[model samples]
Target chain A: MGNVSVSELRYIVGPSSYDSVGSKAMKVKKFLQDYFPSQDYLRRLGVCVFEAEANLAIHTTSGGDLLIVIYNNRVKVVAQDTGPGIPDIDKALTPGFTTAPEMARQLGFGGGVGLNNIKRFADSFWLESLKRGTTLVFEVWNDDSTQFDY
Target chain B: MKINEICKTVDAEILQSKGRLHIDIHTAFAADLMSDTLFIIMRDEDPLLLITGVTNLSVVRTASILDIPAVMIVRGKNVPPETIQLAEQNEIVLLRSKHIMFVVCGLLYKAGIQGVSWEM
Candidate 1:
């Protein structure tokens, strides 16, 4: 992960066509680390982004975009993927529940913790998946200034 | 234990080293799942090592995200060149051992290295 001082960042990640999840996620983590002040917050955000990037890379028919918006009070992340959306969003969010194919399992992914991890880390989380696509949004506060009940 | 001693105990080959032989290691986390690895709680001063049988690039990526510093690939799995390259670029140490994951963890534990604390 390299550092670039910026308020926002976006990158397209895969349909498992390329092994770019780690590198791409690293870049996102580096970008956030440069601006975010809390180590704990950064770590939580890093885990969420890594999981989101992995999901987009492995599950989508076509790769998706990871959009990040950094603000004075909080940081927001949005992950969008095209086609073949999750039929059961609740089941997918359950820990230890996964529909990841064998290939993803072999790579040590699809442990069914991705969405839950995001939900756990983000101060606010939202997700929507239809027949055509899926969109996930979450935000983490920069500090303890704001807290929300999950 | 130090990196060199840990290597000797497991009979590990250093595929990539960042001159980390002398650094003391107090904690480690062993898992084949990158998702579980992400839940490991690592402090800035705590130099953690990752023990996994997985040979994919994501292993390195997970370690990098957690700042785990080094990875010990057990069961002598054939690692991809790109994974090694990524580790090199990130200055993350890579080690390979013929031993299985369980035995490697056992040896390290006996040598005073402890399992990492979890965020959960």
Candidate 2:
């Protein structure tokens, strides 16, 4: 099927953005579950949303914004953070390679799987980083096009 | 095993049941690392329980997002109020155990709870 935009939503992510700091990720997950496609798409979308949100919260200094665009057969997620870009994109994308602080590690994150998980779950992915910030955009198809978990 | 049964087997305290103690769970995935937990694709027929040493909001978040029915915190780690509150809100059963990860796994295994087999 041809790509057709269906709906779009955006949210700010930071310490003071939500009543509970990390609860925004769950909200995104719930929103997609109710409005987007289901089954494999929901599974993959859930992981991508959580990871992207976690990366924005744990890695960045000033937090970021998450934009979710739902298409006819896919969902595109673009997450952009403010300041202190990744020094090594390659290393950051590596599984088990992490620079997350101990506090984040204790929270079961910063295990270096956030970016890797996003890359694996997304049908197509793109990333850009500068000293000012980092931005990641990826898409997961609604149809059971392929199994990315394997 | 049912959520309540698993709790009794591991000597775990039922921190937050949300009236979900009767739910049957057949598979389990234990990890202190949430990133790894996210990698697992749980099957729908066999409800999964998350066994973790971490007592943080992310554990609850991971379980909630993945549709995991219950979470068992090992080593008797003190779960914060917010984590327990979140779990309750999500309707996810939260459990706490004094046993370490290895021991808890063994106990659950003996109780007929199987480790999750990730579909390839």
Candidate 3:
């Protein structure tokens, strides 16, 4: 059961948000590219979603899950995890300050750039983590006719 | 220098990989911190060579998503067999250079491999 669109993508990752999991995001990108070959915004959307997936896997508990939703007008990525919440939003969102697990650092996901990079490419981003877990949402507006010159 | 040429010149033992070198790179920097490399290196440049001291699955993970095709693990250390296997799985060329990261990067630069203007 997924979103129904002329062309839509929804990816779900449960705690396997490692660097390897980026391929899941790529799968959606490939599907979208089949429809919009020259759409740069869609490409950008893929990059952000990949980062969010990495974030969820690196920071959240193993059973945590991340979801990427691609609709007709916008691509939204939601990463939710039943793991320890981020204690400091400001610092965690910084460009190079990461609290990622050591193993994640070795793989290159926690250069502390995931969120910032996601924010840089995404049109709107919201990250909320409470005692239960963290929920991150990233959206990118896509119309697929021209370049996004902003 | 071309990535293929760099591979030939150094005494780097291929750990895991096989793919045509699609792009030629001039200079490179080696570091364990993905943060430093992300800011310092040019992401768009293909066949960009990265030498890292980090020995973890994340190393391959970062390099793969970033599209870095060449990763040289330096120092006397070696990547775990699984990580090496993983690097191969991802189509990223993993090599073990007997030279330390600093020396390898310096030699490549001295031999005219190249370097992007790194800004702070």
RMSD of 1: 3.4
lDDT of 2 by residue, A86-108 (tens): 99899887778998888777667
Clashing pairs in 2: none
Give per-residue CA lDDT, model 2, range B1-120, as digits (tens): 877788789998999979467888888998988878988876667788999987877788788778788999999989899889989999988899999999999999998989897532
* Best candidate, lDDT: 1
Q: List the residue pairs that clash in candidate 3.
A: A106-B59, A107-B58, A107-B59, B26-B113, B26-B114, B27-B113, B27-B114, B27-B115
Candidate 3 docking category?
A: acceptable
Q: What TM-score do all the candidates reach, one by one?
A: 0.89, 0.88, 0.74
Expressed as tens digits, the lDDT of each residue in B20-97 for candidate 3 is 354577656677876555444344543568788877766666565556778888885857887888777768887787
Off by over 4 Å in 2: A1-5, A15-22, A37-39, A147-150, B118-120
Question: Model 1, range A1-150, lDDT digits (tens) per residue?
Answer: 334344888888868743567677788777776676566667677888898888898889998999988877577899998868999998998888888888888778878888888887788999999979999999887655664332
Docking class of 2: medium
For model 3 chain A, the run of ten residues with the poorest summed lDDT: A1-10
Model 3 residue B48 distance off true place after TM-score fit, in angstroms: 1.4
* Candidate ordering by lDDT (highest first): 1, 2, 3
Error of 1 at B8 (Å): 1.8
How do these models rank on TM-score, best leading? 1, 2, 3
- DockQ each candidate and list the results: 0.53, 0.56, 0.27
Q: In model 1, which residue pairs have backbone atoms overlapping below 3 Å?
A: none
Cα lDDT computed for each candidate against the true fold: 0.83, 0.81, 0.67
